[model samples]
Target: MAVAIRLRQEGSKGRLFYRVVAADQRFKRDGRFIEILGTYDPQKKGENTNIDIEKVNSWISKGAQPSETVRSLIKRQVKAQASN
Candidate 1:
């Protein structure tokens, strides 16, 4: 199966929190997942993203493809880390 690094919606209806996960491409957005790599809280003032870059990179190195939004988040994470 082609694994995809993606997001799963959680929290309340109006206020959504997201879990960044690795899952099968055929699975539903909020369905079963292989791993919970991290979280994204857009409501936070700063550093609203919390991810384990090592884990993300590890998964990618193993042939996991990240979704468009997840790829963007990963890029931001990489940039943030580089700036630190």
Candidate 2:
């Protein structure tokens, strides 16, 4: 089955939160996921994303594609890691 890395919505309506997950491409968004990779909180300022790069790399190497937004987040994480 095709796989993807994407976000799952959660938290209250006005206060949105999301979990970054690895799941089957055919599954509905926010439905069954293979694993929880990390989180994204847009409401929070600075450092709002937390993802396991090692796990993400493993998934990507295994052929899991990330959504557009998730792709950007991953880029940011990589830059952050490189600086520190």
Candidate 3:
């Protein structure tokens, strides 16, 4: 099975929260996830949306794929790191 790291939507309408998860590629967007690596809360302040960076890196290292949106987030993360 192709493993993927991606987001699952949460919260009420007009307000949104998401969890970053690892799951089978064939699963639906919000379907069962193998693991919850971290979360993304846009409502939170900088760095408060604590992601398990080590876990994410570990999954990536293990050859888990990331969806397009997750890939964009990864790109942004890289840019942020570069600017630091």
* Regions of model 1 farther than 4 Å from truth: none
| Best-to-worst ranking by TM-score | 2, 1, 3
Best by lDDT: 2
Residue 36's C-alpha lDDT in candidate 1? 97
Model 3 lDDT vs. the true structure?
Answer: 0.81
For model 2 the local lDDT of residue 4 reads 96
Q: Where does the lowest 10-residue lDDT sum fall in candidate 3?
A: 45-54
Q: Write the per-residue lDDT of candidate 3 for residues 17-55, one digit (tens) a residue.
A: 898899998999889989997777878777534456678
Worst 10 residues of 1 by lDDT: 42-51
> How accurate locally is residue 64 in candidate 1, as Cα lDDT from 0 to 100?
99
**Candidate 3 or 2, higher lDDT:** 2
- TM-score per candidate, chains pooled: 0.93, 0.96, 0.76
lDDT for every model?
0.93, 0.96, 0.81
Supply the global lDDT for candidate 2: 0.96
Tens digits of per-residue lDDT, candidate 2, 1-84, equal: 999999999999899999999999999997999999999999999999999999999999999999999999999999998998
Off by over 4 Å in 3: 74-84
